[model samples]
Target: MPIIDTHCHLDNIQYQDDVDTVIQTALNEGIEAILIPGADPKDLPRAKMLAEKYPEVYFAAGVHPYDCENYDLDILKTYITHPKCIAVGECGLDYFRLPEDEIEKAENIALQKKIFIDQINFAKDVKKPLIVHIRDASDDSKTILMQHNAKEVGGVLHCFNASEHLLPLSEHNFYFSVGGVITFKNAKKLVDILPKIPLNKLIVETDGPYLTPHPFRGTRNEPKYTNNVVTKISEILSMSKSEVSKLTTENAKKLFKEFDIKN
Candidate 1:
């Protein structure tokens, strides 16, 4: 079975010069499919274009918390209905870069929360799974997901942060997406938590243009690096690389039902 990179920012400027080559390289290397997440509304068009041009590419439509200030539901709705647009997000709370001023930080958090909740509801309304992005605000993200009854739509926690608090989400129809960060030496926390995640809830991502895996840590990331992530996961889970790839690809297809993998 081939691997699936469930979350990759192929629309980023980093791939502007040679995206076609990048996609072909990943396909040649056994990466069966790639998902382009919507971080900024400005990038959704580019994402959609890539998805339309490549049969193996699909996309999601939602704003990242950092771009919450520009969250416009109307604009997102335009892309959400695309045949290749399979999920609702890359959206959630990101408290990693809040303002230094207490008042500014509070306001920023409020805006992020509001936008996150709105997206969650939108996903439910559309009856599509979500591609959530949670950072340092795991508690808030978990609470919001539960309160909003996000289980109705389920989701993949893009780049799961090894937070024990989120493990129970597996029962709520949420899957944990492991990425290149798992190969980092300092990723002991995630390494330790790897086996704790239910195998069925496991999926893989590259989060390309960021979190490039080890031995290539300083370089740009691409979907082909999903192979590195699968290798690390197989080692941690005491399974073969093919086993890990099959399971993760199955989990991804389960969550993003629109994925039309022929093989």
Candidate 2:
């Protein structure tokens, strides 16, 4: 079955020693495409370079919520025009880890919202979809997305961990992607909600070098682990792996139209 690991950080330092090997292994493992999402502003250049190096690889350009400090939108804009830069994010609100001080926390949240909104507008301007990252702030994220009329281009809720309350966003052109976290034994919440998510609105990913799936939770994740993600989703949905893979791959291509799956 063909697969697309829609959110991986191949340019991260963890894979610096053997990114070539990692890409080849992922390809050999039947991954048809891999998207490297930008987190820090400085990483976009390297992400762009990697996308250029591999025809099967693509990337997005944006600053992650945590990295929103002193973000330079100018740099992001410069790369957003790159043919290989398929989306505008990996950008959204993540209140999971915030400053301990009340004042700092409030300030941080505000900054996150600002940057997220800016990226949303950037996506609109470029006529590209977003790759949103929301955690511990799904309500706020949903509100902001709605307020900005982000559905004009649509996007995926990468590594989706929000409440079922936000599931209705499917009508607004929002899709979801699950990662190794779904394979965890204690991921009961996510597992229970798995089937609830419309299959066509779901895609599989491996947030590589992090969230390694069960039985390999301690090791750094790689794109090849995407197969494990597909298998688990199959088990949860009571469907064959191939069926899940094909549908998810199609869903991914549908969201990321730049993939050119015909090749």
| Best lDDT among the predictions, by candidate number | 1
Q: Put down candidate 1 lDDT per residue, 1-263, tens digits, no spaces.
A: 79999999999999999999999999999999999999999999999999989999999999999998789999999998899999999899999999999999999999999999999999999998988888899999999999999999999999557998999999999999999999999999999999999999999999999999998999999999999999999998899999999999999989899999765
Clashing pairs in model 1?
A: none
lDDT of 1 at 145: 95
lDDT of 2: 0.90
Question: Against the hidden reference, what TM-scores do the models get?
Answer: 0.99, 0.98
Best by TM-score: 1
What TM-score would you give candidate 2 relative to the actual structure? 0.98
Off by over 4 Å in 1: none
